[model samples]
Target: MSDGWILGLDLGTSGLRGVITDETGEIHAEAAAPLTDQSPTTWSAALSGVLLELKPHLSRVHHIIADATSSTVMLWDNGVSSPVLMYDDGRATQEYAAIRDQLPADSAAHGATSTLSKVLWLRNHCPVSSGTRIAHQVDWLNAQFLGFPPPTDWNNALKLGYDPIREQWPDVIEQLLSPLSPPKVVPSGTPLGSVQEAVQDTWGFPHQCTVHAGTTDSIAGFLAAGAQALGDAVSSLGTTLALKIVSERPIFSPSHGIYSHRLGRRWLAGGASNVGGGSLLEMFSLEQVRALSKRQPGPKRGIACYPLRGVGERFPEADAKKAGLWPDKHLPEAVRFQAIVEALVAIEKKGYERLHALGAPAPQRIFCVGGGCRNAMWQRLRSAQLPHVVAQTVERPPAWGVTRLLADEGP
Candidate 1:
């Protein structure tokens, strides 16, 4: 055992979370700071505040890894690695068209959610800052520790059009992203550099600490759940349902809205859908949703509702119309709600089954996470849908997985 601990930082959409994890994947101390706003200055200050909170435990910590929202993007100044643009700062909407036009017809085009697409937008709109080193959320946060540019993890880079299978950035992309050298890419667990001496001194961290390249939050959650088997999978049920299955190769699903993310040696193929418990919240308050769910009107009356809380969906674009509940013989409101829940669960099941049909093997067990995990009704319904498959809940925040990668700690 290495006589050191690993620090896991999760740059969450809402806040910056820091955890000091030992080799056994146990969190020693955890701290959190809500982001005042999704701005570079805000994030940097929040991160520094978190470091201060964790400073007391710095002596034993020797490694640092981070997991962040994949959608987060920023313009990194090459000189000081300063962020000129924030990830959630969507001022670059106009620049999306420039890159979308350039993308090959068959190849995927990252939407406004991608770091690359956002950078392309920023470059055009803010022409003076065109030469900045743009990086994803985790990479940018990691960079602050070393006071230098940080490398992006493979899983995090996959959406940015980095070809993980080839283990290199594509030539076509390089030629297209001319003038800007490909951002340094590294494996998720690779030790890039050590915490800078200045940071160490200020934060009271060990001088020997080495920071490892981590992954996106979803990838980290998958790791924490020990989704290692060929068919093991994880489902994160939040505002949107994000599901991933471990596979040997990428499963393309531009039609069904599935995208693949490389997690270590395996590929995590899945999709996100607009249908989640959030729909219930949108319609009713959280307490109301819980109260309504407790009503428990037995099995649904077959009223299918593609509950979409958003304007459009990346998957099953046809559902953009916000189709209402299918009327069937005076089904009770409680029954209709149950039916909607079943339909949403069925959508995720369909996504998994589609991936299997597309050549990826079906998962034997599904590890559940996020808010949905607490709902016994949903769990029972999901289990009933796939009677043979196991559904287990492991209440781990995504930060735990980042700690594993940074610490090289096995489950």
Candidate 2:
């Protein structure tokens, strides 16, 4: 195995994390810095701080890659003045409607929060000069090391309407985004160029060290799970329960919030549901949930519940007007908590079932990640609900996945 180390950085919603891993994927060192805000200044500061923390090991590093939250966008002329429009920003409703009218029904850009919609919105509301460049969060972050104009990966450009399969911007999108230039697109893990001279001089990186194209944070997390077979899957139990499975055929059902990201010869198909740790947080403190989860109750039929943080539902059954359901307030707290856990597992099973019906292979095994994975009781409950499928937790964060990409590309 090569002795050189690889650096992976993940720019998440809450913070920036960097991991230094050897050729075999064993982490040598890791560091993180929390972001106080979403502005380019804060992001750049956090990134620099994290890299400084990893500075001691820079000389051994051969490659660097980064993943950022998908759909977060910024406009740049000489430098950034405005805060990035985060992935969840909903100010592009009119742009979304216009995109829906222009693109196919199954296009990922049909949603209001998509990068395409945000680009259209920025064009009219946050106008930039003709010489300006538009870039996704990952693109901008990677450019900090590799220099501009920024280069983007296919996975990060999906919501921006770059057709990965065709490896080109579609005529419809080109017409809609007239005058503004799209960043050069390449596959995730493709090398952009060597780290800039200024970065190398400051960080002590080797002259040969290079920066590779990166994916979205979600896709990087999926890669970290180490799932390679057709039926392998990864389930994220964060604010929402998100699922993605490896498949030979891509699936797209915008109505159900299901989409696919290309993974080499295969596809990663899945969707997110409005049910997860957010439901448990509603009634119990972190300490209370930890204590309550340990006191397993005897087998009892769970109360019917749809544990959403608020109104509306996506995946399994997509209904914008769907209301969140809950057990009677009079029920014991332990009972209510267990019932909610079971209900979320049921929703997970329904999500997998939906995927199966839509042509994706049934999940042969699942690797779990996110904050909820810490709850052993929830893991047990999930395993019991999907008895035939093997379930386990992957402790590595998304930064490690980008390290894997670097290792795959070699020194």
Candidate 3:
């Protein structure tokens, strides 16, 4: 195995993050650049800037892997289409319904903004030429390094209707969208090819550096958090709450917004809840939240705040028309803030319960990530609700996770 450094790049919704690390996991260099927009040209420029920032370390890098926000897709001919559909874009309602009617009820493609739905919408509304291709953000970004028509990993392909268990595109999907061709799917860390000569010449990357297949950003985060055991889990307390538990068997419950991503012999199963730090931010500023964190959480106030950003809920309950529930308007600011924190913890507890009930191994320990994980009071609140599962904070950037892929280390 090559002992040179591995380059892991994460193309997130807002920016690009790159890290250069050795096989022993020592960080050599790291850099990040903000993305002003989601357009293909913008992505290209931002990525080029980030790579240039890492140009000093390129000579030592042997392999490269990447991860991107789930379901962020674009149409590719000689180049990417204008105005690529973002992961959360919900303009494919009709296509979503058509997909739901054909796939199993438990399939993750039920969501209106799923990659598969986007593809269908593109076929009808966008109307690409026969030679045009469908590619996710990770695929397109990585293609700049390896080549165009990039091969995608299973995790990124899940919402696109690729059956990871069968390791092939289902006939139903092929027949349903016969006009479009899907990219080749491969295991997350499988080598695709070498870095293109142009990239090597421009960035000073090693001529022999290989480009490996990549996964979605969430999975990349899970891997970076170092949850390798079957029952290990990671909870991301970002703008929204997301959970991923490592399991020996896959779990699929679309009704509850639960699904699994293949992780070699094991699986990563969990869901995202609409309730999280975003809810707290809506009612209080970051300073206020930090101030409230200093206040000890009193006994269960029975606030029952079903914190949703808008008129919908995904995990623990999949009610599209569900409204945000909050404590009585008369409650004090401190009290209400504590209640919201507790309510999010309640949602996390229920999410784990649902996963356990679905045959996933009970999470022995849960690693916390994202901005909300910094709140000591909230961590204590979560531990109180999930006493059986240990809660601890972990700093695992998605770029680090993809670096592990290049190292061929199991998550």
Candidate 4:
């Protein structure tokens, strides 16, 4: 039987999942729905499907917790909000060019995928009303449950230019969108409001159920990883390889492809490298890559290959125009394989170095999370490349950490 159950929904970039867990982190029931970079109607429909699957056990669930993929922006207007753009939508190149012109010469352009660029793109393309307010994905989701406009949580607001350290949206946001509505800002874990009475009734949840302000999935995953203090970093390897290091102070590195985020009690500073395993897979079929790994000792090869397939360059290199797959000349499969592995390891190492150089505490140990942790060869390569540091993988995914958080009580 379920006891002190909580519902944690992960609104991931690939899909949506709901896990019902007890106070001790035991998952009792779960449901998931497939999704993609679709419109608001699509996301709503998918979420509804997943919730309906959890209907039979609804009575056991106490709190509803959720966090969507970060930086996805939506338009809030006429009570019928719609998803205008996704974080990866590159249609905003022109908008990005415009923003760079406004930014300080020292302030490198915000990544093309940032929420600010998305907002600018929509404003330029769609005829949104001047009264419209734009919000991150999860913020809009919270608004749906509250039956009113909802504010963005601090962490998710970072990419939108909300000053988390100061707890205020930047004035530039107003200046950029002259008649645009300003979004209210809230702290992570703060309850936006109680779930709408009608939704409560339909879902068989308590009428007094609170709707906690959700964050990005990555932020929730990091929190769930049991990273007790600062100087800890979490790396996720999926469609993209991303590293996030928690810092006591804000660390901005537009040059390093770095973006700053506020998570739990500290700020998350790191960058996403364009060259992840996925991009490598494109050049070498999965079967071929696995076969090659059997003959290669990875870091032992000493070949240099700076990953970067399509997305420009970030960190260490810091050149947005830097071309990917460097060195016009070529090398053998074994060397290329080693270079590829080292390239990613280099990103990990350089990231740590950059963070330390910025005055952040050094990480004594890095807790590895995500699919990359499962790759035995990748682990060996990382160990060889980072001999000074220890990397350990958790059997379960960091996403499961979200379930653990919902089931526990904390301040």
Highest TM-score, which number? Answer: 3
lDDT of each: 0.72, 0.83, 0.85, 0.69
336: Cα error in model 2, Å: 1.5
- Per-residue lDDT over 202-251 for candidate 1, one digit per residue giving the tens place of the 0 to 100 score: 88888888888888888888877766678888877777787788888887
Which ranges of candidate 4 are over 4 A from the true structure?
1-4, 104-109, 294-299, 326-332, 387-392, 395-399, 403-411
lDDT of 2 by residue, 167-281 (tens): 7888888888877777778877887899899999999999999888888898889878777678988889888899999998889887787989887667889888877898999
Clashing pairs in 4: 256-315
* lDDT of prediction 4: 0.69
lDDT value, candidate 1, whole model: 0.72
TM-score of 4: 0.89
Which candidate gets the maximum lDDT versus the true structure? 3
Stretch of 10 with least lDDT, candidate 4 = 402-411
* Regions more than 4 Å wrong, model 3: 388-392
TM-scores for candidates 1 onward, in order: 0.90, 0.95, 0.97, 0.89
Give the candidates in order of TM-score, highest first.
3, 2, 1, 4
